[model samples]
Target: MEAVVFDGNKLKLSYEKNYPKPEILDDDDVIVEVHYAGICGTDLHIIHGEFPAIKTKPIALGHESSGVIHAVGKNSVYKVGQKVAIDPNKACNLCDFCHKGNYQYCLTAGINSTIGIWKDGGWAQYVRVPQQQIFALPDEITTEQAGLCEPYSCVSHGFNRASPLKVGERILVLGAGIIGNLWITTLHHHGHREVTVSEMNLTRLDIVKRLETGYRLVTPDVLAKENTTYDVIIDCTGVGKVMEISFNYLREGGKYVLFGCCPPAHTTSLNPFQIYNKELTIIGVKINPFSFPSAISWLKAMGSRYVDYHKLGVKTYALSEYADAMEDLKKGSVAKAVFKVVKD
Candidate 1:
């Protein structure tokens, strides 16, 4: 099986034609024949050696993917030929957090138990995944759209983290990348029409304009001048300075959802007085714990009507064309990039 592997020791990513294919070790595991896999921002981090991939040896690098089950496990309910999407975040059911029903804080998180990040993931022809991480797609969602389910679920988790958020509340999403676009569309679907999104990429801004929702797209340079304050502000840029400045956009009692992955060592100055005066709430969101089922349903209902992949600037490339895909993404030519592991 061909795979895009990241050699952490060498700090390089390569296309290996004869990479070892995965096999089911656990009776509850199933081998998915990958169809399409999205290249997430974390994949870029792994490529650049920014993400801590030394958790294990070199591994296939991709997590947001959808596929058909090629091999089924004895204990799994799903059979071969079933279409599904992977959640990637495998929680240790024995942890205290798991016992408390908070799977996101599972003890395995620190140990890089996450698929693609530490273990072999969906970038290859097939990946062995626990049945718990797989969600069978409905008849309405194409396998291509299922490839998007993982990222959409992550965004859903972030949105769900901002509890008590009303439908008509003012919302702002920073960054027009994959995560940012997902946040905007999720808000739009929930009747949050008058939403604002900040992005520097003109191409992405143009794509954001096609959205049937609000048209408050603006570049970073002119963001502060908009004089806009939002009831809920979501930071998807993951840039330290962007996250730092987003604090100013929240209304007096607004909530700030820190959904982006900022660099570990990045620091920002805090204004304790301003926070005290505003009574603003700041919360952080992690991986998609229990969001895949809802996300797949949302995608089914919103397909083409509200969540148009082409309008979102998503394009698929052959796994062998990873360089071209990565180039387009880095150049802001596409909002989301996915590898077409198998032909349509």
Candidate 2:
């Protein structure tokens, strides 16, 4: 099997031709023949040794993917040939957090429980997944849409963390990457319009402009010059400086949703008095817990009926084009990049 492997001892990613095929270890395990695998910003962070909580190396690098069942366990209810989306994060049902219905915080999920990050994942032609983490895809959605299940779920979780969100709030998304674009799309789906999206990259800004979502797009320099305040500010940049400076963008009683993955060792200084006076609420989301179902629903409604996700700049490349995918992502030329592993 061919795969993109993370060098165990070094901060390097390599495309290998003869990677070992994954075998089912448990009676209920299922092997999915990957079709579409998304290259996420977190993958770049992991490659640069910035992302924390990585438990293992030499692991396959895709956590967001969609495919079909190549093989199923004897005890599994799911059958082969079924299309599905991968939820790489798995939680132990017997844990304390699981008991409280907060499985995202499951203690056992901290290490080898999650697939793409800690164990082998979908960066290969085949990936072994626990039966519980497999989500069946509906016929109404395409495989490309399903490949974004993980990040869509994460954005859904983050948006909800900033509770009391209104339909006409002055929302500011600080970044125009896939996550930021997804945030805008999700907000627009929920009846929010006139969002102000700030970015330094002109190409990214142009992509958003072409989408014609009625958003107000501007460069960082223009934003700094205007000094306009927003009712809710969402930081999708994850840069230390951006996180620190965004405090000035939020209005009184506004919510600050931290949706991006910043460096684990990165820290910044903020004005405590401003937080106190403005009565701002800062919320941080870890991973999608119970939001996988929501992602499916959104994919069906938003992807199928309301919005065309591909128009948001999600593009698919051949598995052999891993270098081009990374380069495109680094240049902010694509909203989301996916590796097409299978012909589907």
Candidate 3:
């Protein structure tokens, strides 16, 4: 099987023609034939060595994916040929967090329990995952759309953290990358029309315009000069400077949702006095926690009406074009890039 392998060093990444195929490792494991795998910011972070705790040499890099079951263990409830979307987080059921039904914060699995980060994941033709990680995709959802389930789940989790969006609350989303755009779409799907998205990339802004999402798109420079404040501000750009500056745009009692993953060692300065005076809430969303089912359900309900997966600016590349995909992503030329691992 052909796979993109990252060997710890950023310059050591390569596409290999004969990567070993994955085999079912447990009675509850299932082997999936990956159809589409989406490249994520975390993948970029891994390449840049930002996430040292999860970095593993010679590992396949991709967690957002949709696939068909090629094989299943005897104990697995899923059948071969079942189309599914994957949740890459595998929890240690015995952990205190898991015992409390907060598996995303599982002490044992939360740090190093992701598929692409800690183990071989979907940047290949086949991947073997525990049966618990697979969610059956509705027949109406295309394989390409299913590839985005993981990201949508993250967006759902973020919304859960910032829930109770008032009837007419004004919202601002900083950054127009894949996750940011997903936030916009998800907000629109939930009937929040007064939303603004600030992004510096012209290509991404143009993509948002073409979606006809009614979102007010503005450059960061333009947004900086605006006097209006928002009830909720979500920073999807993990830059510490952007996050620090966004504080000025939040309403006094507003909430700030940190939906992006800044470097683990990075820090942003916040005034403790301002936090106390304004009574502001800072919300941090980790990875998806039991949000996959909600994401899939919402995607199925929307069915291209509220959220058109095709127009989400997904640029597809073949597995062999891994380098090109990474280059485009680095250049901010695409909102989302997916590897078409298998022909649909």
lDDT for each residue of candidate 1 in 1-344, tens digit (9 for 90 to 100): 99988888888778899999888789999999999999988778767766667545888988888999999778999999999998888668787887776788876662257788878888889999999889998888888888889888888787778977797788888899878888888887777777888898988999887775765888887877868788988899877788678789888998989888876666777688888999988889878888888899899988886567787879988878888988998898999898889865
lDDT of 3 by residue, 1-344 (tens): 98988787543578998999998879999999999999988888778878753433678878898899999998999999999998998678887888887887886685467887778889999999999999998898887788889989988988988988875899999999888888888887788899999999999998887667788999999988889999999999988888888887888899999989888877889988888988899999989988999999878876776455557778999989988988999899888889999975
What TM-score would you give candidate 2 relative to the actual structure? Answer: 0.95
lDDT of each: 0.84, 0.84, 0.86
Pick by lDDT: 1 or 3, better one: 3
| Better by lDDT, candidate 3 or 2 | 3
lDDT of model 3 at position 4: 85
Question: TM-score of every model?
Answer: 0.96, 0.95, 0.96
* Minimal lDDT window, size 10, model 1: 106-115
Candidate 1 residue 226 Cα shift, in angstroms, is 3.4
Q: In model 1, where do residues sit more than 4 Å from their true spots?
A: 109-111
Enumerate residue pairs that collide in model 2. Answer: none
